[model samples]
Target chain A: MRIVLIFALLFAPPLNTKLGAQQKPAPLEEVKVVATTVLLGQLVQTIGGDAVDVDVLVKAGHDPHRVLPKASMLLRLKNADALIMMGLDYEHAFLPALLEKSRNKNLQDGGNGYENVGKRIAALEVPKSLDRSQGADLHPRGNPHYDLDPENVRIMAMAVREMLQKVDPGRSAQYQLRWTEWDQAAKQEIAIWKAYLKPIAGRNLIAYHNSWPYFAAAFQFKIAGFVEPKPGLRPSPRHLAELEKTMQQADVKVLLMESWVARSEASGLVKRSGCKAIIAPLLGASKQNRSYLTSMQALIEMVGVAHGLPTIQEFKRDAKEEQ
Target chain B: MMAPALLAQQDGMSQGAERRFDPAWNPAIGVALDAFGMMVGGGDGNNEANDSITLRSMELSLSSRIDPLAWAYTSIEFGRHEGAYEVELAEAAIWADQLPHSFSLRTGRYLADFGKWNTVHMHDRPHPFAQGVRQEFIGGSLAMDGVELHHWLGIGDLPVRWSVGVGANFAGHGHSLLAAESDEDLSLGHAHGANFATTSAGDFGLPGFAWTGRVSAQHDVGDNGYFQWGASAFLTAAGLSQEHDAGATTELFELGQNTLAIDLTWHRLAATDSSSDTIGTEFFWNQRDAVDETFDRVERLQAVGLWGFYLHEFNAHIGAGVEGAWWEHADKDDGGHWLSGAEAGRQVAIFAAWKPTEVQRLRLILAMNQPDPAAAADSILAVQWSATIGSHSHSLDW
Candidate 1:
C-alpha cells in the first residue's frame, strides 16, 4: 500500500500543497496589476514592489498599435481587479474589441477601476486642429507618445501608485514607499541618460513616425521631418519627392527609424538623401530583452551610434564630425 | 496558452465520460450592433438629398467546435439596404481543422479571399470603413458563394499560408444614373456587369455559368513582419449570353468572354509591444476577352494603388499619426455603346485618437479626397468623429 501511494504521488500529478509551498503565493498584501507594454509593466513592478503583479500584454519589440488582442487577453481583463492602459488610440485597433468581448466592467472606460495613464502624463505634438488633409497625418490633441521620455514615466508611476492604493487601501503606505523608490530611480536614470546624450545634443534628426517627442526633448534632438506624409497613410511618390527636397534643404543626416517601421522604405530614403538610417528600439526591452533598464541602455547605445559617438563605452565621448 | 489550458480541462472531462455514454453539443453565440450613416446630399445637385443619421446594423452568429478537428459557423444579419429593411446571409461555412499535413477545407457561401479588404467586413475591419480604392476596385460591395481549400507550409522563420477557391452569384448591379447608352454597353467586364450588360437581339445560343478560381499566399518575415500576394481568374465561356424582351429580333445571343484580375498586400506590424509602421500597395489588372464580334464590346480595367500609415505612442495615454493614399484605374473600350475613361486620384488624412480605456477610442480626423471624372468626380473635404466600441485590430490585413 505504501509503495503504491508513493508511486501515485510521484507520477500522478503535482500535489497542490507541495506546489503552493515551493512557489510562495504572491503575497496577499501585493495586489496584482497588468499593463500592455513591457516598459510600463516593469515600471509598475518596480513601484508596486512585492505588492503588485504587473502583466504586460504586448511583449518587447512589438508594435502596440498593431497588436491584435488575443482571446486570452479577455480572461486577463476579466480576472484583473483594476485595469490600466495607455490613453491614446495607440492600442486602438484591438483593445476596444478585447474589452467589449471580455465584458469586464472594471476595464471599461468610466468604470471606477479604469484609468487612462496618459491623462496623468504630459503629451506632445498637439495640433491646432484634428484635420489631416493639409500637411501630413497629425495628432490633434497632441503627440500620443509621452511615455518615451523618462520624466513622463514618473508621472505615470505616481498615477499607478495612487490608483493601486485607492483600490487596496490597506497597502497605501507600501504603494507610496515603492513609488518614491521608483521615482528616485527613474530621475537618476534620466539624469544619467541626459548627461550621456549631452555630446550629441541639439542635433537635428528625422523620424519615420512621431513617436519620440519626449525622448527628443530629453536628449535635445530636433525633428527635421517624418518620412510618412501622414499617419496611417503610405508615402506617395509626390509626397516622397517633396520630403526628399526638404531633406536636401535641411541637411538632415541621422534618420531615427523605429525598429517597427519597414527599413527598406527608410533605407531607400537614406539612399536618396545620403543619410544614415538606423533601427532604434521603439519600445524598451521586452521578455526577449529581459528588463527595461537593459532596453533603455540598448536604445541609448543605438542613438549614440547613430550620432557617431563612442560605442557602448562606460565613459561618455563627444559626437564625431558628420560622417 | 489558453488553448492548451482548455484542452487539458477537456481531457479531464473526457476521462470522466469514458465510463458513461455521453451525447452533447457545445454552442457559442455572439451579437454586435453597429451604427452607420451616409451623407448623400452635397453632390452635383441637390437632386440627391442629404439623408444622414446614426443607424444600427445588428448581427448574430452561431458557432460550434464540432470536434477536435472540425468546426462550423453561421450568422444572420438584419439591416437597411438602400433605405429598406433587409435580412441577408451574413455568414455560413464549415471549416475543417488541421487535417493531415496542415490542410483544410471550407465550403458554402462565404467571402472569396481577394484583397485584404474582402476578408473582413466594414464593422470587423481595422479602419472605420473600406478605403475608397477597395470600394472602387475590388468592389467592397461584393461577396462570393462557393468552396475553398487552403494549406499552410512552415518554412524556417517564415510561415506561408495559401488558399484556392471558387465562387458564384454576385449582388448589386448599378449603372451611371447619369450616363446614356452606347455600344460600350455590350458584353461588359464582370466588374461592370452588375451595372449594365448587352443582350442578343435575336433568339440564338445562350451563355453558360460563370466560374472563378483564386490563389493567395502569405509569408511572415522573421520579426520585421509579413507580406501577402494573391490573384484570381474568372471565366464564363462564349455561351455566356442573356436575352431581354426589349423589342429585339433575337431572344438570346452567345456572349463568350473571359475576365481576369490580380492583387497583393504586405503588413509589418510593430515589433512585439510597440506601435509599428505599416505600408501596403496593390495593383489590379482586369481583362474581358472579346466575345462574338456581333456582341457589343467593353474594355478592361487596370488599377494601381498604395496606402501607408504610422503610429507612435507619446506615452501610454497619448499618440498621434497620419495616413495618405493614391489610386488610379485605366479605361477600357466599350463597343460603341459608350465611352470609357481612366480616373486617378489621391487622399490624405491626419488624425488624433484618444483611448481613455483600452476598449474605447474617441478619434477626430480631417481628410481630403480628390475624385476621378469616371468615378464620383467631385473632391471631398471630410471631418470625421469616430468612436469605436469594440476591439478590431488595426493591423493592415484582409
Candidate 2:
C-alpha cells in the first residue's frame, strides 16, 4: 500500500503549488497564452511584449481552416493561462476537440481566460440563412478572415492586450504601454498604405475565393466577382465563363489569389480575361512575412503593383524627385 | 472604421452588442445515419438473410454543460434488428469536470474503456463488422452501468493518462451488447441462477460487479508523427457457479473471467498536404475459469486475439485501409485435456472511403473470414453510407 501510494504521488500531474498550499503568496508567473493562428500569435506577441509568452498552434503557411491540433499543441495549451483565437467558427474544426482534451478550464470558451478576438469585431459576408448546399464551407457567423485587414489586426491587438491585462494584472501597465505604441504605429501604417492604394481606390478586382472581401472593404476596392461560384466550391467551366463575362463587363484587370490555392484555374482566368493574377500570402507564409506589419505591407504592394499602381517605394522616390 | 459598420450590418449585429450567450443557452444537437448493403457467400444458415440492404443504425446525440462543474453527453441509437425496429440507449453519462489533482469522474451508462476499439462507436470503426473474438467473448462491447474516474499527468513533458472504473451489468451467455435483450433474461446458463446478479446495496451479491482499468502514454515520434501505447484490463464474474461433493468433501465454485490487452498506435500527417497515415495494433488475452462437478477439479478456457490495421489518406476526399485479425481459443476440461474448436478464426478486410465533406462518408469493403474446423471460408462485399447533421461526431481522446 505504501509503494502504491508513492507511485501515484510521483506520477501525478503538476499541481499549482500556490493553490495546493495556502501559505505564502506565490510570485507572479509569466502569463502563457496560446493563439490559434500565426497572425494572431504575432499580434499577441507584439502587444504583450515581454509580459507574456505566446505559443502558436497553426504554424505559418498552414491553412487554419484545416488544422488538427497535435499532441504537442495540446501540451502547449495545457499550461496556457489564456487562449486567444479568431473565433467565428474559424478554428471550429479543431479548437473544440483540443480544448476538450486539454481539460484546461481557463482556456475553455466562456471562461475568464478565453479571449476571442473576432467576437467583438464586426464580421463580413455572414450568410443570411443556413445552407449546406452552398458547398459546406460557409461560415454561419461571418467570414473569419478578418485578420487579413490591417484595421482588424489593430482590433485584434487591442483584444490581446485586454486578455493579457486580465490574466496578469501585475503587468497591466506594461501591456497598456506596449499596446499604445503598437496602436499608433499600426494607425500610421494604415494611413500610409491607404495613400499607396489611392490610385486604384475604386478599381474593380477579381479574386479566386471570398477571402478578400474584408480586405477589399478596408482598401476601398470593389470585388467584381469570385472565380469560385460559392465560398469553397470549385469553379465549373460555366461559372468561369460567367465570371469572365462579368470581369470583361467591369473591365477588371487584376485577379488576386492566395499562394496556397492552385494557380491553374486562376492562370486560365487571367489569360481569358486579360487580367494580371497576383498571388499573395494570406498569412505569414515565410519567415520574412512573419510579422503582421510585414505581411500587410507585402499584401498592399502586391495588389498595388498588380493593379498598375506605382509601388510604395517608387511612389515615394517619385515624390522625392518632384520635391 | 467604415468597414466595421459595414460588417456589423453584414453580420446582423447591433452597433454595440457582441456575440454572447443569452439566457436560453442550449447545447448542440446532432443526428447520424448509417446504412449499408451487403452481399455475402458461404455463411452457414444466415447467408440469404444477410444479403440485403439494411438501415444499420440511426443515432441521436446530445451534449451540453449541465452546470459550471459538470458536462453531460447522451447518445441513443435506433436500428432494425431481427426484422424489428429496436431502440437502445447507447450512452447517457454526466462528467464532473472540475476535480482536484487533475482528476475527473463520470457516471451512468457508458462504453467501458476496456481496449482500443471497445470505446469507439460503431459508425466510426474502420471495419463494418466487429472482430470475431470481440463478438464471442465480450459480446461486441461492454457498455456497463457504472462510474469511471480518470486522471491525467505528464512525466517529463510526455503526456500520460490513466483511468479506473467499476460497473454492474448482465454478463453471460446470449447477452450481446447494444442488443434488445432485457437484463433480467441474461442468466448464467442454468449453472448459476435464473436471475442475473444485481449491484444494488440491499441485493449486493457476489460476482455481480465488473471492474476495469487502463493506462496510456503518448509521445511525439517526429515533427509530424505521434505514437501512443496503452494497456487495459477488465474483470467480471460470469455468474456461473456450481456445488459439487466427493465422498465427505463438498465444494462451491464460481466462474470468473478476466481480460488483458495492449495496443500501440502511430499517426502522422504530411506537413505539405492533406495526406495522413495511421497504423495500430492490439493484442488481447482472456481467460475464463470454472470448477468442475468433481470437488477438486478446475477448468480453464482461454483466448488470444491479435489485430492490426493500416489506414492512409491519399488526399482530402479519399482514404483506404486494410485490417486483419486472428483469434485462438483453448479450453481445458476437468480431465486436463485441451480442446480447440471453430470459435478460433481469422479475418482479413480491405476498405476504401470517400468523404465528400467532413460530415459525410461512403465506403466500400471486401472481407474474408476463415473459421477453424470449417470446410470453407466466408466472403463478403459491402457498401456503407454514413452522414451526420447538426454537430460533429462525438470523439474521445484518441
TM-score of chain A by itself in each prediction: 0.78, 0.86
Clashing pairs in 2: none
Q: What value of lDDT does candidate 2 attain over all alpha carbons?
A: 0.73
In model 2 chain B, the worst 10-residue window by lDDT is B185-194
* DockQ value for model 1: 0.09
- Fnat of each prediction, in sequence: 0.19, 0.08
Q: Tell me the spans in candidate 1 whose CA falls farther than 4 Å from its real position.
A: A1-323, B1-26, B36-42, B131-138, B171-224, B232-273, B289-331, B334-376, B379-398
Return the top candidate by lDDT.
2
RMSD of each: 16.9, 11.6
Give me the displacement of residue A210 in model 1, in angstroms: 28
Q: Is the docking of candidate 1 incorrect, acceptable, medium or high quality?
A: incorrect
Give the CA lDDT, 0 to 100, for residue B138 in model 2: 56
How much does each candidate deviate at the interface, measured as C-alpha RMSD after superposition?
Answer: 10.4, 2.7
Evaluate every candidate with DockQ and list the scores.
0.09, 0.16
Question: lDDT of each prediction vs. the true structure?
Answer: 0.55, 0.73
